[model samples]
Target: MKKVLMGMAIASSLATMMFVPNQAQAAVEANIGATSNYLWRGVSQSADSASVSGGIDYSDDSGFYAGTWVGSLGDGNGAETDFYLGFGGESGDFGYDVGYILYHYADLDDGDFGEVYFNGSYADFSFGVAYTVNSQVDDGSLFDTGDIYYSVGYGFEVAKEYSVGLTYGYYDFDAGSDSDYGHLQVDISKGDFTFSVSRADEDSGDDDTKFVVSWGTTF
Candidate 1:
């Protein structure tokens, strides 16, 4: 049932991106990267190990966009594939984004879900909210609809081609335990290549503080 809904959502987004005649000037982009650990929302997704990731995106001048991302998830977790569609535009000094994202775990049966999110940013500061709409895990025992996450972030340039960022997030679950976490990151870019170091603080369950390094490029 959940899988069916997931398929429908992806199909709908794809159709919209492909058939939307107004987006005739759409541009395509691709990115690839490697990370020492795959951390998602402050939780380790790659069992604290390294992973490879990549994605492709389509965007137009009208603020509509769609993309697909994939990452290797070490050991028994298999791979993670994400599909998202959104529209983002600037208003004065603020930018807003609204979108739906589906996370599909290949070879990890019952470990898939979807979320709808709204994000706003001004200058170097940002805030966002996400709500889980569906979960495929063990009949939604591990993750269920209505789970919400709130986040705030800030970033600043420290030097030429270097920057620092901070992020904090709180997860409120409808079925499971809740958690609060924070992340500090530093990034350096040279041409098309970027290097990053990120540290996360865990505030609940067995999640622990950890650090990760990564390198990536976009084309």
Candidate 2:
């Protein structure tokens, strides 16, 4: 299962690279950051492990965007890597996002697949949802268990170079799944540095707390 996830991550990254939007008036940007734990849709991608993550992105003045991101993770059960491609746009105070992400790992089964996501933001609050599709498990049983995830967040400026945000997320899985996930997190930013902490709930495990400290700059 783990190896399969890793393969999906690689394939998704390559797919994004092979396909670029035909556009004019687009501006390119890049950013990189690190965190003690990598969390996705409220699940611990790094488990209790520490990791680093970064990505580069491009956007058009008319509101189209695409980007790739990578990360490293460890969760005791297996080591993990992630690659993702995302597109989004902003119109006035509202914005929307659509993207695909692949999860991969070594010492595990291998295959490629991804999740489709969409979300929108307005003012200090934003919300979004996602679905995991066609993921296969090592046992020859496809993780027919798909996922639906949603989140909401609010941000406030604290200083000339600092801001803070609070977010909440919920996840629901397909049948026979006793385990689900959710999280409430707070993030702080100063200049190009951002730090965050989240209290997570996993259906099958004790509630976990995760922390992230990162530095990023836009160019």
Which one wins on lDDT? Answer: 1
Number of the predicted model whose TM-score against the real structure is largest: 1
Q: Candidate 2: lDDT of 198?
A: 65
For candidate 1, the per-residue lDDT at 146 reads: 78
Taking the tens digit of each residue's C-alpha lDDT, what string does model 2 give over 28-58?
7665655555555444556545656566766
Q: Locate the minimum summed-lDDT window of 10 residues in model 1.
A: 6-15
Query: For residues 110-176, could you state the per-residue lDDT of candidate 1 as single tens digits?
Result: 7788888888878888778888898876643535687777777776777787666566666676655
RMSD of each: 6.9, 5.9
Error of 2 at 131 (Å): 0.8
- Lowest lDDT sum, 10 consecutive residues, model 2, at 4-13
Q: Residue 115, candidate 2: how far off, in angstroms?
A: 1.1
